[model samples]
Target: MKYFLLTTLVSLAFLTSCRTLQNTQKPSAGAAHQSQEQQYKAAVVSKAQTAQCVTAKINMDVDADGKQISCGGSLKMKRDDVIQLSLTFLGFEVGRLEFTPKDVLVVDRIHRQYSRASYAEVDFLHQAGLDFYALQSLFWNEIFTPGSRDVRSQLNRFRLAASGDYTSLLLTDAPKLNYQFLTRTSSALLDRVTVDGKTAADQGQFVWKYDNFTTLGGKLFPTSMAVSISGMGKKAGFTLALSRLNNDTDWPTRTTISSKYTQIKATSLLDKLAGMAQ
Candidate 1:
């Protein structure tokens, strides 16, 4: 159970929280006979200029640490700066994660436990060079560095090459993350992201694959996603399918943790995570 919560929900950062940011979509350049580098640069710029999403509702099937769970969830932005993600099973909420600029709040319904911590308090994440925005980029199907808000600068670090139907953008010299972003050449949509990184004692790689693009709110969005993390002395993976998506501007800004739950310290959360990773 601990493994399921930490590996599937916490580590993946699939949860969303408050505030919608403006994303302006620009006209894209046609592939034509442009060089691989040019095509990649164009895609990156186009995605960056695209309008950001407001809210989403997804149906997900999660598997991690040898456990499987099926659930429904919604992603909402409050006040244009905070994002909240809530998960439900059989009409009962089982988990919620709220991400702020400086901290993260996690709730586990099954155990009546909750945890709140900043990025600095999460040693594994600091070692792996991960942050909320890095994971948030995955939710948007964009390439990003953990702490960088500038997507263009992050794209500049990668070398682009044509690989079959996809353009592969790779960052090999990065200290912690060896990253690759793959996008379909025909549609210029992000198809996959694969990155290799490690904690202090464990090395792991995560792959996120996106598929089945459908137009939502005048822009393309993937309808399905498959994410897998391997190594770390264990393997974790999940598949998320979009059930409903909207441009709704209304959503709760805070995750309500009932008084029945006990809030735990961050260290206890880390200990539990380490044991599960092993």
Candidate 2:
């Protein structure tokens, strides 16, 4: 159940990055001209190509079947470069996972468990239905970067628009997740994103507010976020407070895994699981 909650939260985070906008009255001529001017200014000054490093604290709240569980953790990330994450649950350190463009590592500090894999593991995780990459993109500064071709294809499924000093993209296919991206007129760094997933059909919606941004190494990153998931039956919310951001630092060079769980052995385990399912 915990893993299910983690996956759901991460997937929601991904959808939040591609939030949809609401319908508004058409703008006057003067307002339209002002919007074009702002877009031009944003194109000229937006930090679209810079890289950055960041660290954050995340608090998660899971509500299911009338029961609730809460957990907290920290993350360190480099934009389009690397990411290291450590999560704690129930007062026990869960594990530390790291991702470079070329490699992946999982270190269980408490149990002295570790695992390493090549970039192929990224796809493997995706196939395993894990949203690790999505989570990393949220914490890092690369969420504003153009999404993958596949992601673009999915986004094209919706209609998007722009509002005052911010682009308001709208998604109509999934009513349960209304997505929007609020960006400064002069930057790609999103200022605020409003997600309204409620309508006459759905009972309620979730809203996540991001703020406390600071520039580091020529890129901007958020230091705090408040997520509120509300519905009629089960409503859950929590705040993710971040601190201690470090730039251009390397995590552990090598991770030691148990001899019984080397790369070859892990692959064998995966293969056995696949065979059993067949």
Candidate closest to the true structure, highest TM-score: 1
- lDDT of model number 2: 0.49
For candidate 2, give the lDDT of residue 99.
Answer: 70
Measured on C-alpha atoms, candidate 1 has an lDDT of: 0.67
Minimal lDDT window, size 10, model 2: 141-150
TM-scores, each model vs. reference: 0.82, 0.54
lDDT of 2 by residue, 90-156 (tens): 6666655577655656554554545556644544443423244444544542232222322333433
Across 153-262, the per-residue lDDT of candidate 1 in tens digits comes to: 66646566665887666666655556677878777788888776423343566788998877776778777889877655556778878757666755566677789989
lDDT of 1 at 71: 76
Off by over 4 Å in 1: 1-4, 10-36, 48-52, 77-80, 197-203, 258-260
